[model samples]
Target: MSAYMVGYARVSTNQQDLTAQRNQLNTLGVPEERIYTDHGLTGTNRDRPGLNQALAAVRDGDTLVITKLDRLARSLPDARDIIEELTKKNVKLSIGGSIHDPSDPVGRLLFNVLAMVAEFESDLIRARTREGMQVAKAKGRLRGKQPKLSKNQEAHVVSLYRGGQHTTAEIAELFGVARSTVYRIVQRTPTLN
Candidate 1:
């Protein structure tokens, strides 16, 4: 049987457009029906429903196509794992138009080298980010996200919960915060020793 080309497109956030990737896949003659997508999902997350569906739909003599290497995987290990599965199924992985067949010696080497380079790049980025965060911390600038509720509001939330006057949901509704926020306030409150 001739190999069918299957395409996958992903975006990390809902605000990001998938149009560009879709256009590329369409240009490559991947039928609209065969293109799968994961919207507002991170590449590192393997639990993506769309990715699972695409992988499940591929047959032995099929080719899986992605617009970019990063779109398919976030880390080297993940890339290797996916490739290994495809190898077992005799499926070809196409990244940016470069086809890599796990059954081929040269393709295996090339794919490994590419995966290593991508891993190295990701590691460098993480290192740089850590260095930046450290510098910011030293400068008293890395305070992270601000608390959604004020101190008085949190105290009120605690009091309401302790008084058994309202449920966490009720407190959250009254305070205009999430039930999780109310739980945090309760957890952080000091207990009498």
Candidate 2:
């Protein structure tokens, strides 16, 4: 059977654009109906619905195309696994205008090298992020999400709990918060007046 081209596009965040990837697929002659997209989904996330659908729809002798290697997968292992599965099914993968044919020695080598580079890039990003966080923490600038309830609201929750007039659910409802939030407020050590 003649190989059919299937395209996949992805963007990590809602703010990131997918137009360029779509345009690339269009330039490759992939019909609009054959292109799948996962917007606001991270490459590291394996549960991309669009990717899954594209893979499922592809048959033997079909070519799966992506604008870039990272758009297909973030890590080496995931990329290798996808390639292996597709190879087993006689499907070809084309990334960034290069077709990675498993039957060709050079293509196989290139695919492996590129996959490792993508994984290394991801690891570097994580390491840099951790280093930045450590620096911020040392400067007392690293902080978690702001508390949902204000100090007065928390005090009111504690008081209501101490009075035994309201349950945790009641306190949560009264304060427009979750039951877990009410429990956390009550469990914390009270400040000395």
Candidate 3:
């Protein structure tokens, strides 16, 4: 059977566009119909459905195409695992139109280096995000979700509960809040004699 190309693409966030990658794959000669994609999924995650489908679509003598190594996998181990699978299936990997030959020592080395760089970049991004969040929290700018009710509203709800004139559901509906909120207010507020 003649060899064909099956393409895979991924973006880490919903806001990120896949047009550039798609166009690159198209330029690399992979048909649009054969291209598979995973949106809003990080490369570190190995269980993406699109990746699985792309792998499954390729058969012996077929080629798997990607715009970049990082788009396939971010970590060295995952990259190696994917390469191994492709090798076993007698399928080839084309990164930006360049075929990866696992049997070649230099090619393997280059692939590993690329995978390591991708992993390092991912780690750096995670660390920076954590540091930013810490700074925000220290400045009290990261205060969690605001209360659903104002202090006066909470006091009124508690008073209504204490008065035994309304059910939790009734109070919840009256204030457009959940029954759980009314229950929480009742639990936290002190009972007056």
Which candidate leads the pack in TM-score?
A: 3
Q: Every model's Cα RMSD, please?
A: 4.4, 3.3, 1.9
Residue-pair clashes per prediction, in order, are 0, 0, 0
Residue 156's lDDT within candidate 2 is: 84
Worst 10 residues of 3 by lDDT: 101-110
Q: Judging by TM-score, tell me the better candidate of 1 and 3.
A: 3
How many steric clashes does model 2 contain? 0
Candidate 3 positional error at 114, Å:
0.5
What lDDT does the true structure give each of the candidates? Answer: 0.87, 0.87, 0.91
lDDT of 1 by residue, 1-193 (tens): 7789999999999999999999998887788899999999987788888888889878898989898877878788888898888898899888878788988999988888887777777788889999999999999999999999889978878888998978888999998888888888899998555
| Model 3 TM-score, all chains together | 0.90
Per-residue accuracy of model 3 over 83-165 as CA lDDT, tens digit each: 88887888878899998766567767877888899889888999999999999999999998999999999999998988899
In order of TM-score, best first, we have 3, 2, 1
Per-residue lDDT tens digits of candidate 2, residues 1-193? 6778999999999999988999999898778899999999988998999999989878898889899898988988888788887877788888966788865678778888988898889899999999999999999899878898999888988988888998888889988999999888888947557
Relative to the true structure, candidate 3 has a C-alpha RMSD (angstroms) of: 1.9
- TM-score of the candidate numbered 1? 0.73
Candidate 1: misplaced stretches above 4 Å? 147-193
TM-scores for every predicted model: 0.73, 0.78, 0.90
What is the C-alpha RMSD, rounded to one decimal, of candidate 1? Answer: 4.4
- Give the higher-TM-score candidate: 2 or 3: 3
